[model samples]
Target chain A: MITIELNGQQQPLPTGSTVSDLLSTIGSDGKSVAVLVNQQIIRPENRPTLMLQEGDQVELLIFAGGG
Target chain B: MDLLQLGSHSFSSRLILGTGKFSNAAVMLQAVRASGAQLVTVALRRFNREQAEDDLFGPLSTIEGVTLMPNTSGASTAAEAVRAAHISRELSGSAFIKVEIHPNPQHLMPDPIETFEAARILAKEGFLVMPYITADPVLAKRLEEVGCAAVMPLGSAIGSGQGLANAAMIELIIRESSIPVIVDAGLRSPSEAAHAMEMGCGAVLVNSAVAVAGNPPEMAEAFAEAVAAGRKAFRAGLMQKSGSAIATSPLTAFLGATL
Candidate 1:
C-alpha cells in the first residue's frame, strides 16, 4: 500500500498504483486542475502513466471560474 | 491596439506595471505614467502600524483611472490566497486579483496546485482571477477553462531577468488559448517585453525591470514604446517560416549548364 496526501489529508492507496490510478480511484472530475507529487508538478501527459511510490504525497488543484 | 478586458474592466494598454522595487513613491508614479500601463499590480500585506504615515498606498492611490490589481504575493496556500484576495478587494474596492501562490521564497516559483485551487475559489467568489504560473500549456488551458480573465505565465523564474526561457510553451499557450495570455515576471528589459508581445501574448507585466533601472522613467518609456511596436508587429502579421533554403537558380539554368 502507498500513502498519499490529498490537500493535506493522508490516505492510503493500493500498492503499485500510479497517480492516474489513484486519481481514478478518488473520482476526480477532470476539470482544469494540476497535480503535484512530493511538491513537484506532474505534467498532464505524465499524470496517467507515472507510477506512485510508497509514502508519496500528492496534491491535486482544480482551477475553476469563480467570480 | 485591442483592449484587454479583465472581468468588467477594459484597458487599451497591454503593458501591465507592478508597484514594487521603486526607489520612492515619486519614481514609482512617474514610471507608471511613462509606461502608459492601465493595469498596475500591487501586493497585499500588512503595513507597519507604528508608522505615522505609510508612503506606499498614497502614491498608488493617487494614480487616476489606473486599475489596481492586488496580488497575493506572500500567500503560499489556497486559503491564504483567498484571504489576501478578500483583503485586497476591501482595500482597493476592486475585484481584480493577481493570484500568486509561491510557497518557496528562494525561487518564488508558483505552486501550481495551490494557485489553481485558489483561483477556483476566488473565481467562484466573483473575483477576477489572473494567475501567475509557469509556462505550462496544460496549466494555462486549465486556468482558462476555469474562467480566469487571463493567464500570466512567467518568462523565467521571478526576478531572475531570464527572458523567455519557455518560448515553445508560451507559443503553445498563445496558440491554444482563447483568453488573453500575459507574459509576466523575469523580464529585465524593454526588449524582453517586446519579444513577449511579438510572440502573440496579449500583454506583459513588468516591475523589477523598470524599477531597478538607473532611470526608472526612461526605462518605463522605453518599455511603452517596445510594447507598442510589438503589438503593431503582431497585428501586422509576422512572416511565415520556411523549412529549407531555396536556391535562386532554376532547373533550366542548371540543365543549360554553365558549369
Candidate 2:
C-alpha cells in the first residue's frame, strides 16, 4: 500500500495506483482543472496511467472566472 | 493623456495589459512591449511544473519598467483575498494589491460587499488597493472611501469581450469617482478600448482580447496606438452633441443683424 496525500488529506491506496486510478476514486470531471503532484503541476496528458509512489502528495485545482 | 499615480508608481499608458491567454510566452512578451503598458496584471498562483523552466514569470519580470500588478484572482472571500494579498506582497515585494473577490465563476462579477470589506482592511493595512467591481456608482464611492488607489469597474463580464454592457453605470462611475476610474475586462476590440477612454475613463485593462488575437504583438501595438489617440482626443475635447446641423455664423454677424 502507498500513502497518498490529496490536498493535505491522507489516504492509503493499493500499490501501483496510477493518477487515473486516483481521479476515478476522487470523481474529477477533468475539465477546467489542474492536478499537482508533490508541488508540481501534472498536465492532463500525463494524468492517465501515471503510477503513484509511496508518500505521494497530490493537489487538484479548478480554475474559475475572475477579474 | 493623464498619468495615473497608483501607490509609488506612476503610469502614463492608460492601457493596462493582462498576462494570460497568450499563445506563447514570446507572444505575450512581444504584445506587452508593443502595448507600451507601464502596468501589467498577472494572476498569483504556484509555478507550473511541467516545464523545466517557468517562462511566464521570468520574461514578465525582465520587462524593463513594467510594474507587476499581481491580482488575487482566485480568492473567493475577504479573508482569502487578504491572504492572497499578503502572499503576493511577500513574493512580489510590492504593496500594490488588486483586490478581487468573486464567489461566482459564471459571470465573474465582483462581490461588492466582500470587496469593500477587503478594501477597507487592506487600506488600513497600508496596501494600495485597486478593487475590481461592477460599474456601480455607489460601490465606486465606497471603494474610494476605503482609500483604494483606483476603482476598476468592469466594462462587461470578464473574458466575454462582448464590449461595454453597462455604459450608463460606467459613465456614472467616471463622473462620480474622485480617484482614477479604470475600465477593466470585457473589452473586445481597439474601438471598445478607445470608447472607454473617450468616456473619460482614466485607464482600461485588457487581456483576452490581445492575448487571444491571431498576432498578439500586432494587436498589442494597435491597442497602444488606439489608447493614445483616444486619450489625446479626450484631452483635446470632443465636439458637443447636436441633434441637427446648424449653420456656422460668427459673432460679428450679430452686429450686422443689429444694424
Which structure among the candidates has the greatest lDDT? 1
TM-scores for every candidate against the unseen true structure: 0.74, 0.77
True contacts kept of each: 0.00, 0.01
What does DockQ come to for candidate 2? Answer: 0.06
Interface RMSD of 1: 14.5
Q: Score the docking of each candidate (DockQ).
A: 0.01, 0.06
Quote model 1's TM-score: 0.74
The C-alpha stretches of model 2 lying farther than 4 A from their native spots are A1-67, B52-55, B248-259
lDDT of 2 by residue, B1-259 (tens): 3677786678888888988877667778899899989888766554332541333445666888887777888889998898777666654556888888889998888999889999999999999999999889999998898799999999889889988888789999989988888888899899988888888888889999998888888898888887888888888999999999776865466777787
lDDT for B196 in candidate 1 is 90
Query: lDDT by residue for model 1 over B11-109, one digit each (tens)?
Result: 889899987778766788899899888888877433222431333445566778787888888799999898777656755667889999999988999
Q: Estimate the overall C-alpha local distance difference test score of candidate 1.
A: 0.80
lDDT of 1 by residue, A1-67 (tens): 7787766777788887877787677664322234667867666678778888877777654311110
- The model with the greatest DockQ is 2
